[model samples]
Target: MAEKLSSSPPARNIFQRLPLLGTGGVVLTMAIAVMGIVQGLRTISPWLRIGNNQAKAEISTLVVQQIRAVSELTTTIFAMETVVPTSQERQWGNFTLGRTDLLYIGYGEVRAGIDLAEINEQSIQQQGETLIVTLPPPQILDQKIDVERSRIYHYDRGFLNLGPDTVPELQTLAQRQTLAKITAAACDQGILNQANQKAEVALASLLKNTGHRQVEIKTTNPTVCAIPSAQGLSRDKING
Candidate 1:
């Protein structure tokens, strides 16, 4: 005898019915890959943040350098030489070494200018849009003897040259004297005045970048910015 079939369908494992080779399977795999990438980014988030902050700090430092324009301005205006006579004699034990006579032509360079670096918080005052800066006094920045440009026009070593060769000493003395003379001459010729005027112009231009439409430069106590006096020696004696 034959039996009648039931109307309901048979049940199966859910895993067995899942799509394995079609678009649905591919979509699920892609979703999992996206989730993995997101997790990786989260793990390195702190390191990425540190890198970004460091880059920003470096850029800010560069910006400051560009803004502090001409904080120190130096001027080399005059380079010249003078011819002078100098002599030196040395004594060792009981014997006089020997004397040296030198006619030295030395190149003297005068470095005179105002240092804007001297500008302090007190030096600069703001009144509305104008900037008032009290500049330091103009003075001789430096006095140098150019060895390469200098030469001994004449050198005389005493008879038989008993003393240690004093040519170098005489040369050095001549250079020292020449520099003093140059400084005095520059002062007489108004080098300091010129430097002060130039400072005003240069600093005004530099401060323009600092957002100040107007800059007023004034000098502090005007000092006796002349070369300190030293006895000028001639033929081993003070030139009276």
Candidate 2:
């Protein structure tokens, strides 16, 4: 009966009380800890996402620079032979004074391609893992007559030298005409289309080789083929 002799033992410390927490209590404690860690992560997730997006943006910029470094890409070549008949006539008021006739057999080439230097950051876009590149329109890059392969097949002064002695002039005219004709023919034969197709294929291969697994190439319609003519030459100067 001295001080009622209390039967209750001393209170357990946190470490000692942990063992009294049975399966359900232990599970609840773990859940609470997990939730706290998740909350901490959530607090910093926005910055993490921003950093990831920034890294991707930088990579896309570098890719754009790499593409623009390719400069000009020649994709297709059109070569053919043409026969051009050019003539000149001088008239004196209801009477033909003189005439010159020249037959030219010319071999020419037309080059069609894209100028990659025109590519800019705007031309390229990235979506997840794929890249979309919009290329410049295909155009006539170069056209020329092969001087060594071209020649004046025939020259006629027309009726006892009544025509002007303009061998060199007529040859020059024929060459200019040859270039125009070949360029027109090339355009008619789908040179621009060929350039576009080949360019797409070539770039796809190039991008794939550079570690791009998915790439889409887009092209623009070609401009009209230009027919070159002498600046001051008149219709009267060219009879044919």
Candidate 3:
């Protein structure tokens, strides 16, 4: 009738008419997601910091242990070199031969007494200055031998007798004994000198190996110092 009132389709619902409401809901979801991510990062940050601190402490402890170990090794080596003799001297033999006249022919033999004296460790320590070592006292070994002989010879109606003669033998023996004594003395002196040189070398090597150097302390309350690195500060090097 009245031109059918020219009616359009029934009015749309508010939910369908306002498309921006859907967009607003999507924005709110995105904001919530961003907030969740930020919270997760905050929760993990403290654990990462704690792990980093623990690693740094372990590294410092290891360095200190290495230094102490090296020091102890150096000390032990020095003691050994100072206390032990590099060379030793020993008496080999001593003997005498003689002829005597008791029967048709006779022979006698005599052996010289040997006395060995070793330089004590105390003496070595007193002479040395580089290191201290404990050493036992010197010991002496002695040996001696004695013999007698007589000989007689008969020719026609006369008898000839012989006795031991030891003057020339004693002179030669004395010369050999003096040479041996000189050799022993020389050996002792040489060994002591070698010990001192060895100690010097050990000390030098220890210093070099340990990188012995003066370090300036940056803080005293917590005992902190700057660690030298090829590239400025340690933090900068690590971060870069």
Clashes of each: 1, 1, 8
Q: After superposition, how far is residue 240 of candidate 1 from its true place, in Å?
A: 33
Query: Model 3: how far is 35 from its true place, Å?
Result: 1.9
Off by over 4 Å in 1: 1-71, 89-99, 158-165, 226-240
Poorest stretch of ten by lDDT in candidate 1? 1-10
Give a tens-digit lDDT track for model 1, residues 56-125. Answer: 4453344334324555556536677899798767778776778768899988678788765565555656
How would the candidate models be sorted by TM-score, starting from the highest?
2, 1, 3
lDDT tens digits, residue span 1-240, model 2: 644454333333555766776766989999999999999999988866766557666766776777777777889999889998989887889899889899999888888998888887678777767888898999888777777788889999889889888888888788777777887889899999899999998887767754566989999888886556633333432323
Worst 10 residues of 3 by lDDT: 76-85
Highest TM-score: give the candidate number. 2
lDDT measured at residue 141 in model 3 versus the true structure, 0 to 100: 19
Distance (Å) between predicted and true CA of 200, model 1? Answer: 0.3
Per-model TM-score on C-alpha atoms: 0.59, 0.73, 0.25
